[model samples]
Structure formats: structure tokens, C-alpha cells
Target chain A: MNEILKFFVNQDRMLGRNERNLMYTLKYNLKDSRAIADNKLFAKRIFKKNKLPIAKTLGVIRKKEDIESFDWSKLPESFVLKPNKGYAGGGIIVVYGEDKLHSKEGNRVWVKQNGVKIYQSDLEKHIIDILDNKYSLGGTKDKAFFEERLKLLKEFKLLTYKGIPDVRVIVFNKIPVMAMMRLPTVASSGKANITIGAIGVGIDIGSGVTTGGVYFNKPIEIHPDTKSKIVGFRVPYWDQILEISTKAQIASGLGLAGVDIALCRDHGPTILEINARPGLGIQIANNDSLKERLERVRKLKFKSIKHSIKLAKDLFGGEIEEEIEEITGKTVIGRYVNMNVEVRKKNLTVLAKVDTGADSTSIDSSLAREFGLLNSFDEFMEYYKTQKHESKNIESYHLESILDFANYRGIARVNNGNGTSIRPRFEVTIKIGNVKKKTIVNVIGREELKFQCIIGERDLNDFLVDVEKKI
Target chain B: MESFIQTAFVSNPTLFYYLLLIPVISSIIAMGRNVVGVKSYGFQTPMLIVFAFLNGSGGIEGSLFLIFVYLISFFLKTYTKSFNLHYLPRIAVIVSLISVIFLIYFMFFFKLVNISSISPIEMVIYISISEIFITSMFKSTGNKVAFLMFFNTLILSILAYIVVLFIPQWFLLRYPEIDILFIFITIAFSRWKHLRFNEMIRFRSVINDMDKE
Candidate 1:
């Protein structure tokens, strides 16, 4: 036993296929649980029995005869046809929508995810091949089934290709260990497998926000196609994702499993499939080790699925925050925050946009008027209205003395994309989260926008921005 | 070494000549996959292909014959897939088509090669190799990937064949203890838990990123 422990300790942090299979997969997974996990239809039944949301089955083809007998016309406009025991996301054809020009009364045509047109005979041939064990783990006979293709959630519509992006949560002993959001890139041919060209973005176990990403086994900070920052993108329905994954792990009776859950625009978080042996690319995405994590939680017990999720979060959560602090020594703040704007020796709670793009802080004119900070600006604007068309030069206005108030600092030149104008600036103090900063802010009329205040770059010196956070 | 083996080991040493190559073949396949990261069909299949090459008319002729069978079987399999036949029966169709093609080739083209070096059983071995190609084709993602896997298997088999040919059998015949050493090598390869060299290259970014800390 000591030899075994020493052997494990001597192994590297990165897990290869052999170590993963010998240690975790073969050791923890039973034959019965593995059988269910290998078959997608059986796993879906288990998920359905546990009251989990899964894709609705459209049809099932058990044998070659069923291919000819089954009504191919009844398939929905957008459905996914997959082999029951397919591995690594193979032999799955996702029909995005219907082809209008090729559909007759009894015969219809559909478009694949790659924009290839499929006829009724083509669908039948695919099912026949699937039943012939074309995509099974070995050469065993298998079944083919069709399920409703999930609609992409609005949050991930831009992040994914034609397919829905799913989150793969590796659960062990009923505890969620690690997770990464598998995004479909164009190069992956609409499949979300990392071995193919999809992007894997690691999700913080505690906060459900993306921490880092791996594309083609290398760390990437932005989505290759979308060019949006990959880090700090908060995954929607995160708690429910963990809960469903844990429950699916227990339901399938697999001690160790990778539960894939896709976020549907209509059904919310839905279970896609479960794997007895999950891939280890997630380690590169998180820049961490799965072997160490699995060893840490191997003997852990939990009260319930929710309790297990809570325990998992507590054990491995917000690691990115600590890493950022270590590297930059700055507090991390989100894109939108509620800040305390000082008004007449009191604090007014104002929702502010933390924009690193702007150079200085700006406030809405209506908010400044209600707070009595724009009384001098009203008189100055009245004098500016009379001299607007008369004088093109700043010195011709002769209003420098009128613009001088106790808090009024100077005029700021502002460009609104089309033209430039001057706005009255003031000295103000504001508190963002826990930190307070004294800065100069320009008062502008921004009643049409969402926030009344926009915090700019100069006041955010002591912070690093998490682009997707909300406080 | 040849006289010593004939005098001490057995009366007919020619019968044991092919048996001595088994361990060397296993070692080549194991080390090729475990260290160099060359994926093939499996250990036994590639080893059998190497034996077939050694038994047939040299390595190059056997490789060319295997490639011909694969291309014919590949096209026949793709063409027969639209017939909606079951997997086994479809494979049978491809094998039968290959047999007919071979019968025609041997009838007209038998004079192009030395007839004494090629046996009818060796011809059967070359034809049956197409079955492996067809099964992998069914499981592969597409024709391009199936071709790639077949190409890799062919290359690995050719490597093993070259080792068996150029390396004098007298060496293994004299140093019979080397077979035991190869068996130990195979055993040691099974217990290897380190990351493969290809995986090291695959995960270079992750490894380098961690090394900085």
C-alpha cells in the first residue's frame, strides 16, 4: 500500500490516457455503470428517471429493418441523429434547419450543421451505418436515435459555432471536481470535442466564471472566431449545472464520470451525455492537475448532491482570484458595480459602469442636477446657449469666471464620435466596492444610457477588471 | 552461429527461424507505440502483417500488394455502403470483389513477378489484409482518416519487415538469450506510466507555462 501511494505521488501532475484509464477509469467505474454511460440512449433514460432535463427523443432505430420502417418525415426541422454508443462525439449529425426548396409533400430535406443538404434516403443510410456499429467503441452492433437539437442560449450564441456549447463537469464520488466549457469553433466542424479544434474554457469551481482557455492544447485568452475575451465570462445557470451533473453521476451509478450538460435557451441546463472516462484536456484549460484533484476528493463523502456541490465549491473555488492577486497585486472588480458617490457629506448609491476604455469618470447631467452638483452648470449652459452660434473661439465666450464654482474644476473636451464639445468637470469622491478614490468627473447628459455614472481608467489604478463580473 | 544452432538446438533449425522473430516484432511494435507514438490497428494485427510480408515476395512487393487491396476494398466498401447491407455482409461483398480482382490480376500478370517466391497461401494472406482496412473504414470519421490510419499501419509494418530482413537471423540464432531480453523489454513497456514523447510535444504549452512558476 505504501508502494502504491509512493507510485502515485511520483507521477507527474498531467494525466495521460494510460494513467487515467488504469487508475481512475478501470478502478472507479463498474461494468454496469460503464455500460449505461457508453450508450447515449441508456444514459438519457437514467437522466430522465432522475427527473433531469435531457433532449427529447424523436425516434429510435434498433436494427436495419427499422431504418426502412421508421417515418423519416416525422423528424423535426432541427434534430440531432446520433449513434447510441458513439464515442468522442462521432457519428452525430446535427440538422440546424430545413431546406425549403427540396421538400415535397412526402419527402423533405434538411440542412446539416456544416450546411450540407440531407435527404430522406440520406438519413436512412446514416441510420443503417450507425446500426452497423460504425461509431461504437468497438465493432459491436449498436442503435441509432434522434433527439431534438437544443437551441443555443443567448449568452453563448456568439461564443459557439452552429452547435450548442456544453459544459463538461468531471464528478468523482458524487463531488464535482473540475469543469470546462467546450465551445464549438468553426474548425471543429460544429462538434465540441477539444481533440478536434474546439476551445476549452476552464470554469472556476466556486464562482462559475471562466478563468482560462485552451485552444489546440495551448492557452488562449480570446475566442479565435469571436475575438471576445475568454477569461471571466460567467457561465449562466452554473449552480444548476453542478447540481444536475452531481445528480447524473449518482443516477448513472458511475463513481467517476464526465457529465456533459448543455444550456438550452428553452429548457435551461440540459443533460447531453455522461462518460465513464473523461478527457484530460481540461487540465490544460484550467492550468491545473486532475490527478491531484481526484486524489484529494477520492474518499470524500457528502450529505446530498447540493451539499456535494457546496463542498466542491468550497474546496476548489475562486482560485483565479488568488492567482491574479499574486501576479498583479490588485483587487479584481467587475464590469458593473454599485458605487457610493459623495453628495454633501453623505453617500448616494449610484450604479456605475466600470469602463476601462474611458479616460476619466463621467456622470449624467440629470443625476448631477438632482444631487445639486449642477446648479452652476445650469447658469453656465444658459450663457453658452446665447453665445453658441456667435463665437467659435473659447476666449470669445469670456465665461471662465462664471464657470468657477466651489467644486467646478474645468472644462473637458469630449468627442461623441461625430463631433466634439466641452463639458463642465468637477472634483468628486466616490467609493467602488471597498475602495474609495478622489477623482475629477465630467458631467454629461446621458439619460438615454443604462448607467448614470461611468467610472473610467484613471480611478481604476488599484484594480484589475474581470470583464463579466457584476457587483 | 549457424553450425552451433544446427548441432545443439534442434535437428531442423529452419522450422524455428520464424519463431525467433516473434519477440523482436513485439518489441518493435511496443516500443514504436509506447515511445515514438505511432498508432496502428493493434499489436497483433501489425505483427501479423509483418509476418505476412516476411513470408511473401520481399517487403516492397508485399506493401504494394497490401496498398492495392486497400484501395480496391476502400472503393468497393464506399460503393457498397449505399446498398444498405449489414456490416458483415457488406464486408463479405468487399472481400469477394477483391478476390475476383486478384484472380484476374494473377491470370494476366503472374509473369511480371517471380512465381517461385509467392505462394498461394501468401496470396491469401495479402488479400485477407483488406478486411482490416474495411473494418477500420467503417469506424473511422471519414475516408481521409481511414486512409491515414491504414497508411500508418502500413508504414509500421514496413519498418518491422525491414528489421527482420536486414538484421541477420544468425545474430538471434547465436544469441538465443536475446529473445528473453526482448520479452523483458515488452514487459517493461507495459508498466511504463510516463507521458509519451508525443504527448510531451502535444502539451508543451501547458508544461512550459507551469515551468515558469
Candidate 2:
């Protein structure tokens, strides 16, 4: 623990106590719950404003007068009664229709599929409890809001039990950092929170990329409740979602936050609530960390929303392959040597891969001879032919490489390590998926790895890669 | 270091009380992140008191004793609640009174006592203090709400502490696992979904299928 703290401190990349504490407090205090609570009132208002979409509010009830004098006929057969400040789906009564409702101690209450009805008196008791504010953020009194319940999206039916499906978009500095679609599980306290027991699907931060759905905190392809595979659902208006989340950061006076969005049949894109203190479950959903990604955002300077979104993508988007490349100081993702290894220096197309399986990225020993550091290896090799180093430093390389990498068109660089003891060949550039770049790499014997001028896994995944299947 | 562990696990007979905290902490983190409750102080403290009950009443036997405890405490709290007393002070008085009575009755009638050689007076004082905190919470809030959360903490902690008991490989690995469990629970709990027993109260209104009440 001391070492870990010292490492982060030595890097000087983390926020100080005041900012870190504020960021965390702001997550719980400034947003998430408050914004969700505000939704009780603003939900109807936002729907009136035509800001994307939301469930229409039938009414917001406070004391007895609100329920007694209100028009009962105006209510849809199926609607949701929720605590304006409720957390974790508390004090909520959902009616499938009139058949599912009953008069309990003089007031009508909603029922679930199992024929459980929340009586009006029970609602009153719950409301009184809320009024007592025992279950509020600061134990403050709250009201109850009634709204039309949303139908679960077809694509999400398997992921959800009976509640509406919600997608969480984590925003930092006005950009969407990580995104996951949370489906309600019976385990999640009857709501779609991943912590209690919900299924989370990692979406591509780019194009809302969705991958690796998990349940019960383990990698799982099928929903534990519904027994269906969770995959391949595209969120409409990906950019707009990020835009709304960014706009919410400004609206909520919070910088680091999450925006809960619901897709309605009529409303299209609805902002369910904004969460200030979003959980780290997002890391499991995305299989990454908010701590590290937030660190990147904290270091950046942006003038407007545009710069922020760009930084979000660069920092936390589907750039895992790229991050690994930068960290290992080796071009690992894209560059692979072939019968025709074409090296080009006129224009650098740098895409790297990450390979934890290998000890060191090996290039042609001739490349090391060019950098004049081959003697260092020889000196160490004289004592022992093999040496091991935990060198995870990034060093850039510019290589003049001619071409012929399996008929792919690109010049590349061999990204080198920071230490001077290791010599780097010229830069090798490999284009994986859509991204391309040049990087410095070390040159060594490939008799073991069996590929000439091959871009190590460290560099191959820097961008994205799809192996071209050909005849 | 020795004193802290001694206090947590050894030397202190009610170290089990602190042991109960592990599950409370886990459950609260679970509730806070996944359950999304406005209630913070969480269910752990009350749960600790509940564990003490099972411990004092001799495990399963104490569960039977809880019925009497509930009836008596409920009658008293009902009086205190209706009197419109300010929350904190009313709880303070009720807790003190309940602690005095329970300590006397439990020690004399149930013949239940915490066995520690340190000091009989200290043991008595400890139980008194513990009772004061639990009783005040019950008096301030209704016993039902306190117990609901208390039950939640107890259930979760029982499972968690039992699992933790099998771990630690003799204490060297114990401390780190606590922190790890904190982080792991934080991440895992982010995805929870389930219904609260409170929902059962809410659902009672809709149970009759429009049978003309």
C-alpha cells in the first residue's frame, strides 16, 4: 500500500487531496442522487421542453390533498409511483393495470406480477417515512411522483427482469469516458444497479462499442436471470448521449459524473437521472479503471465541450490497445513482419500491439547495430547470454523502413524503450484496424518468436485490429 | 499492532461485535452502491447489536428471545414515538433506561454474561454501553425500521464473516483481504439488483386482484 501510494505520488499525475476529495464528494453530494431526485419535478418539465425524451409524469403527489383531490381517471392503467428522492427503487409501486391494483386502508396501491399490492395507507406510511426523511441523502423530506412506466426495449428483454433498462455513461470533464448498459436482475434489489446484482455490458466508447457482458461480477455471456446472451445492441445517437452527459455535468455543477439514460418508445432518448458518485463497477463493465482514466482527464486542459469529448475518447474510449503500447514503451499492436517487410519513413503510420506473453520485443539484430547499442547487450551477454529486465518505459523511434508487410500499405516505426542499454531498430509502422502510427522498437533474434520485423502484441493492439481473412 | 488485533479478535470477548462489523461494512457498501439507499450509518451498527443478541441468547435460543424483546421494546417505543419527543434526546433517555433494565434482567434471569477475566465491572459496563447505543437507535427510529436494516446486516454479515473466518491463513493475509473485499465489493456491488422487504409492504396493497375490499 505504501509503495502503491508512493508510485502514484512519484508520478505526480494524481489530483491532490482537496481536488480528489471534492471530486469524490461531488459525485455523491453534487450529483447522482440529487439530480435523480430533481428528476421527480424536472422530469415533466424536461419532457415539456422537448429535450430528447422521458416517461410522461401523470402527477406528483405530496400530502393527502394531492391524492384525494387529484383526478384518478387521468392515470393510465399501468404507471409507476416512485419516491421523488427514493434510492434503490425504494417506495415505488408499479401497477400493470387496474387488475393489479387494490384499495389498502382507503387508498389505491399498485401490484406486481406476483399479486403483491402496496396499499394507499402503506404508500402513506412510506410517504410519512420519506417525510421523516430517514432514508434521504441528508434526511430531508421528499414527495412522490407518478409517471408512465416505460416498456423494456426488445434488445434488452433478456438482460432485464421487469424494470426499465438503463444505460450508464460515465462523464469526466464533459466527455463520455466509459459506458455500460445495466439490465435489471432480480438480484439487483429490483432495479438496474450492477452492484447488487445486475448484468453490465461494456459498450465500445467509440461508436458505443459493446463487448464482454458480465453478471455476478464475473465474465458471463448470458443473463443469470433471463438466460439470454447480451450482445449487439446499438444505442441510438451515441454522440448525442455523450453530448447530453456533458451538458448534465454543466447542469449539475459536477465535473466527474455519470448520466443514467433510458430509451423510451416515444421519448427516444430520455435522461433518467444524473449520478455524481458513479461506482467503479464501470471498470468491470468496461474491464478498466476510472481511477487511471480520470487521472488522464485531470491532466488535460480543455476550453470547451468539444475538446473534452476528444480527450474522453483519447483517455478512456476504446483505446485500450493504444494505452498498452504507450505504457510498455514498445510498439506492440500493428507491426508484423512478413515475406515482404516494407519499411517507409516518408510518412509514419504508427499502430502498436501489447504482448504480456513475451519478455522483450525482438527485431532484426541489424536494427540494433544501426542504433549503436548492440554492444551493451553483448557486454551483458558475455557474463550471461540471457538477461531479464522489467523495463516498462516508452521511447519513440523513427525508422526508415521500406515496405512489403503481407501486401498491407503503410510505413512503420519500431518504438523503442527509454533505457539507453537497449538498442532500437528504426521505427516500424503497422496499421491495426483503423489506426496507424510509427514507433521505435528493439531489434533481436526472431528464431524464437518466428516472425521477421513482427510488431509485438504490445504494439499490435495500440489502435484496433481485425485479422483480414483472405482466400 | 498487537493491541489492535487483540481488541479486534482476541482478548476482547465481544470482539465478535467488531467481527460483526465486517459484514455490516460489506452490506453497507453493497447497499450504498447497489441498493441506493438514502440511509447511511447503514445497517451495520444495528446489525452488530443484533449479533450480540444471538450471542447472548446463545445463538438459536436468542432468536426465540427476540420475540419478547421486540414486544416489550415495541410497546415502550410506541409511547416514546407518540409523545412527539425530539429525536435524539428521546432516544438518549430510552436507550439509557432500556440498557439498565436489559442488563439487569438478562444478567439475572437469562444468566447471560460476557466471560472475560479483565473485570466484571468492565464487562457489565461494556454491555451497558452497547445496549445504550442499540436501544437509542430503536427508540429514535421505530424498532421495525432499525431491525429491518439490522436483519439485512446480520444476514449479509453472517455469510460474509463465515467466509472470512475460513480465510486469513492465520492473520497474515487477513488485513489485506479486508481492503480487497472492500474494493471487490465496491466493484461487484455496482451491479446489484433485488427487492427490499419494504417492497413487500408496498406490494400488500395490490395483492387482492380487485376482490372488492
List lDDT for all candidates, in order: 0.81, 0.52
How well does each candidate superpose onto the true structure, as a TM-score?
0.78, 0.49
TM-score leader:
1
Instruction: Name every residue pair that clashes in candidate 1.
Output: none
- Residue A16 in candidate 2, Cα distance off native in Å: 14
TM-score of 2: 0.49
Q: Which lDDT tens digits does candidate 1 get at residues B1-213?
A: 666766755665545667888998999898878766776888877888887877778788888888899899988987986687766778888898899998898789879877679867677887887888898887675577788888888898999888888666666666777889889998888766667667666655555555345
- Interface RMSD, in order shown: 3.9, 19.1
Of all native A–B interface contacts, model 2 reproduces a fraction of: 0.00
What DockQ would candidate 2 receive versus the native complex? 0.02
lDDT of 2 by residue, A72-112 (tens): 55666678777676555545666775533344334555566
Off by over 4 Å in 1: A1-11, A324-331, A337-351, A355-362, A365-443, A446-452, A455-471, B1-15, B60-138, B141-148, B162-180, B211-213
B148, model 2: CA deviation in Å? 12
